[model samples]
Target: KVPTWTFHFQRSKRQRDDDALVLPQNQKNPKASRIAYKIEEYNPLLDSSNITPKDWAKIGKDIENNYMDYDGFVILHGTDTMAYTASALSFMCEHLRKPVIITGSQVPIYDVQNDGIENLLVALLIAGTYDIPEVGLYFHDKLYRGNRVTKVDAESFGAFSSPNLAPLVSTGVNITVNWNIVWRDKYQQRFQVSTEMNQNVGLLRLFPGITATTVRAFLQPPIEGVILETYGSGNAPDKDKALLDALKEATDSGVIIVNCTQCLRGTVSLTYATGAALKKAGVLPGADMTPEAALTKLSYVLAKKDLTLEEKKWVLFKNLRGEMTDAAGEPKLCLSDSRFIQAIAKSLSLSCTEELGAVRDALTPSLACAAAKTGDIEALEALKQLGSHLFFGDYDGRTPLHVACCEGNLNAVQYLLSQGATVHAKDRYGATPLSNAVHFRHKEVVELLRETGAHLSRDELDEAGVELCSLAASGDLEGLKLWILAGADLTKPGPDGQNVLQVAQSAGQKEVVATFSSCS
Candidate 1:
């Protein structure tokens, strides 16, 4: 049982008129007893578009003022920019340990067929009953992290969706709460609010034939941050030197430019030459973040006057408020040595020094690298806990990630990333994890590495061609295609001084032989 308060912004699309009170004040019914709750509404509502950073400050202040009075809060907002408001509130409200559910509907409660009533009812129920303390958007039948959600359909009942992350709760016959995925504070810190949000940010979308003049004009004075929406996988035209120069100039002027992909599903990857150019020009990768999250996050980050510009850029790429997926998974401990596994499970400190010594006596750097390549999460965790150095290179200068990428161990790759493995680490032959993933046709691993800002130079690509030729010999059409699309030189000879077609034929890869024959 919990006491509930509703703060209405009066931005519902279903409202017949723009009034302060959408419903009767302090209205309660028999349904209140069933849910074991009491409801109260506040005043001075405004449209969602009119809800700015100042208004966000007001909301935070109100919540802080009445922090102890209620267990949870619900905000009524407009769907037109509900995502923006939600994203803004997620950043503005800091260290919040109580649910702040924002909800609205396509139709008004007065309509014969309206969703507002249900949305409000469910939001109230979840706010009061559930222990979900983060800011969330309750729409259609799902509860999404406030900053992760985007309003997808203007006409459909399911108006919102969280593309990059899973929902906190899915409402069907039974309200299924995914406890594992829900964000929680382990230490239960006191709630705080951030009132200052810099609005001097803008978004520039790239398209075919977009000129340098347009880019330069948009990035002119007054804009401190810009979200540059690029083509698939965060690519722009490398041939467009003028566009690249304008970006470089903006970054040189201390403008924080974030390179995000226009594609909704995947993240912005810096694998291609064009994406590498953007990175060289100092554009930070906005990995899998929706434009709404990117824009609001940039505003929040820029508003932190205490932080340096470099620090702000660092925070921009990190996952804050469950807004974006940082990596796929955490490191798991899997070791044949029960003692080492137990030591890691007990604690990650030096108390396991004895067990670590035993393990280190048997585990060489190459063996540890083999464990990483084989996706031995437990072994990696144990090794890390035992204070094993991660930067040790194999004979070929390949790191654990390089081997994991070649083996297509996405979990190992993600776990390695979480442990601060360098993404752009190069081998003796200059092959990166991305190049290794490409060579092995590990599409998912390639994307993950790219999302982490791994890039290859033209020379590095040429060096990786030897590995790609192996894929061609094995009849790996997908790998061959990816390399071709990435402008790999197919004319290069393999180690045996034979072309890719000759290698394919010798390896009995008829399909690959036919593909090369047809191309020739």
Candidate 2:
């Protein structure tokens, strides 16, 4: 049997390690001041991997219970799933007019050289001092819009990165906040927290050889919503009619399937030819939102029993909190604008001149990425002439070529190709420009990259036994023979963790069963 947890309000309150619930110290709930807070610890501290929606709801309820008592809130969470949690809370907490910053350490706080102390301190300081009314994440002396942030590192102090947007605040000798971008609610709506979250949501990242049977199984029953992490922009394999048929059947039966991108940045427009098939199959475009944001938002949205399926889909696409960049509810800044670029250069004390070195320094990778996303060819050409390497990634490790491919900017892509950008260069998520192009369904860009011999490995699908299971499900005996001839493992479990033999048997493919027997 597994051990149960004992919840504590303070780290010091627990005399018995076996107790189920304990309260915090009286001193922790004193009158409000800078960095005023209370410890709400869970004994047998969970690695964030094990944190479930139920726990997320409980935290939301806790915040709701003490909403007005505190100026702002700080959640000391594990590194893993912190983004997921933050995104969930961004939805759960409606009309938030006070900061709710989540932060944690790469190294344990008890250890020397830990980021915990600084992270916690800054989180509290920002929570108390700032009037920026939204859920943000603090790490390594920088603050990001919560849902926009992703953990780009596993070992470094600089563990998180906001791929699409700049940091909300950067702390140095002085803390600078981008007030133009920080979300503000002027209507003075009351802050309310929602603990209601539908648990029947799923996240599926597509691969080259993922099967219809696997998709059907994963979305089998009791699943209300799914976040389909599609290829570049918002395309899936249009050739896979069976997979499309399965998804069509699901949405026809009132299941919400949101098309989210597997890439780090850009919107899921579902505008390409392949994306047409997905849209016809009842897929909704989840524009430029991270998978973490999509999944949690799906859950939070699905919980509303009052709303119809159509209304729910509408809500999903609508920019609820600044999560969707396409229909941004907040003010937007463009790097292509000379005044904005000048302002940024002025802040860095750099001259906005023809001096290539100064111009190169001013042309940050993030700014270049933004330009690439919007197909600003002028900026690309200028950066190219300034001797800036298109391959150089920002702090988040996103390259210009990848962003261009994601946005399907043919000119930018061609220019980068001519400039000799590495077609196989990977971002923090191991996604190459080719993969990003394919993910976004940039057919022209994909073709261009392919001409330069840019290709991604199909080993993940083969290793997961998708090919065998898919062939078995479809009774493609000849195909199975070829795969097995190339040393495919017939005894291997399928992508859903079921054996290939069992999958064939379940489908009543007698020929496939016999073939498996012969292979054995």
Candidate 3:
């Protein structure tokens, strides 16, 4: 029952007229399709049509009419104006209840590996049957509310993301829905579109030694609002009276001046005296809102001429959807909820739900060194919660599985694995979970890990770094045999250019040395 439309606009011939035609390869061969629209190109955000306003209006009306008669709508739009179109649709389409999902791919439909098919398939699925409507955007396996999406990465296929908003849903082998977050307004939740945007909104990124003349021109009579990209978590130079005076003059003339941070995370607070000056001048903080979100939100709020200016301010400060968090923020605690742990568990191919607590419990070891050092089952559970924090300070580093294997904590080892730890994890030293256990003298831990088919030998460690050599010098015969049986590379030499047999000899363990010789 879902109604879908593919709105394709012809690229304008004039170079300067098509402001939305910001594709990467602009060159066009006279005979073939313009290189700009060649879908095989790397950056799909650039592959946008240079549609004129008249054409867009026509397309919008056509889709809107068709949408009223159908259950949901999926639009195949050019990447360039996608965000703008999303913002525009948030107001333009009236009483929209069913999904009005917009999507585009990095490559054209003609390419063999074109991402268009997946994007289209997902969009159709969302529009065709998915409940909880409101304008939305779906692309590269993630669904975002249309109002919150922004095109960030130009080169990658997953170019668009709603940084201010959590994804409505994500797709893999099975589509996962974040049911709690999806928006559903009960009263009068029907399609009601309006298209009265005040094009007077503008953005200004402050730079060193900016002149009053530049600020004054944009803020004067014509513009109704201006978004100032401020420094740090929203600080402007108090030292510069010219900038301050210009901002004051603009706010005095009834133009709304909004302050937002140039940083990705964190909110804008005018905590400093200098910051106080900007707020005194009537500048408001846009707390954690992305520039794109700020711009579109401003456009959306301004479009509703029905709301008073004060009401607009109130709406901007609070979250309309899941666009922004609080003015102050903290690190996302890995253990507070088992959802992420559950996701990690599913990814690691685990089956038990009752035992899933072990993984969530293990995350605590990542918080404090003592929590992990205690060697208690609770401590090990805490460590599992620490997740990636155990192996590396940043999220990109090793997970808790690395810490357990490195210390040879068998309980922690089993818990991490059962909870969906990646057995193939390598620390900065490139040592696998099995390798770390062997080197750390936890023979039982190594044997248990070996059952999971973890990589065990030198060839497997061809890129195995120097730090792992020190662990191998532990002269663990049982650990070494466990690895050897699991298809370890015999040709890989240690730092001293010694094979496993030579490493055992150098470690002065006769029993280990003999075992290595027999294995060969």
Which is the leading candidate under TM-score?
Answer: 1
Cα lDDT, model 3, residue 520 = 43
Model 3 misplaced stretches (Cα beyond 4 Å) = 1-64, 91-96, 326-520
lDDT, residue 104, candidate 3: 79
Q: What is the lDDT of residue 392 in candidate 3?
A: 25
Evaluated at residue 121, the lDDT of candidate 3 is: 66
For candidate 2, write residues 1-520 as lDDT tens digits: 0111211121121232354223223353343222334566656667888888888877777777755344457788888888998899899988665678888888888888899888877676666555566888889999998888888899899989888888899997677777546764323234577788998999998999999999999887899999999898898999999999999999999999999888988877746889889999999988888888888999999999899999999999787877877553423233334565566667777663544344555465776788788988777766544445555677656788889998999988877666545554556555667667654556777677665545542332235387678778889776666444333478878879877788889999998898678665
The C-alpha TM-scores of every prediction are: 0.59, 0.58, 0.53
Candidate 2 ranges with C-alpha deviation above 4 Å: 1-34, 186-188, 328-520
Answer with 2 or 3, whichever has the higher TM-score. Answer: 2
For each of the candidates, give the backbone clash count: 5, 6, 26
Highest lDDT, which number? 1
Task: Return the lDDT, model 2, position 453.
Answer: 45
| Per-residue lDDT of candidate 1, residues 299-398 (tens digit) | 9999999999889988987777777776676553334345744555456454354655545544545766898878998877777655554544666667
Model 3, span 1-520: residue lDDT tens = 1112453222222232233231233233342212111111222122345543333354456555544233355676777667666655654555443566788777777789788888876666555434535667888999888767777877688888776668888988777766545654323232344545566788998887778899988787778888899888788889889889999988877788889887766678878876788898889888777776677677667767889888877777766644566545434434435566667778876657535645644543344234333445575454434443332222324456666666777776665555434454444344556666766667677667656545442324454424334435786555555555444554466666867666666777777666556654
Error of 2 at 286 (Å): 0.5
Whole-model lDDT per candidate:
0.74, 0.73, 0.60
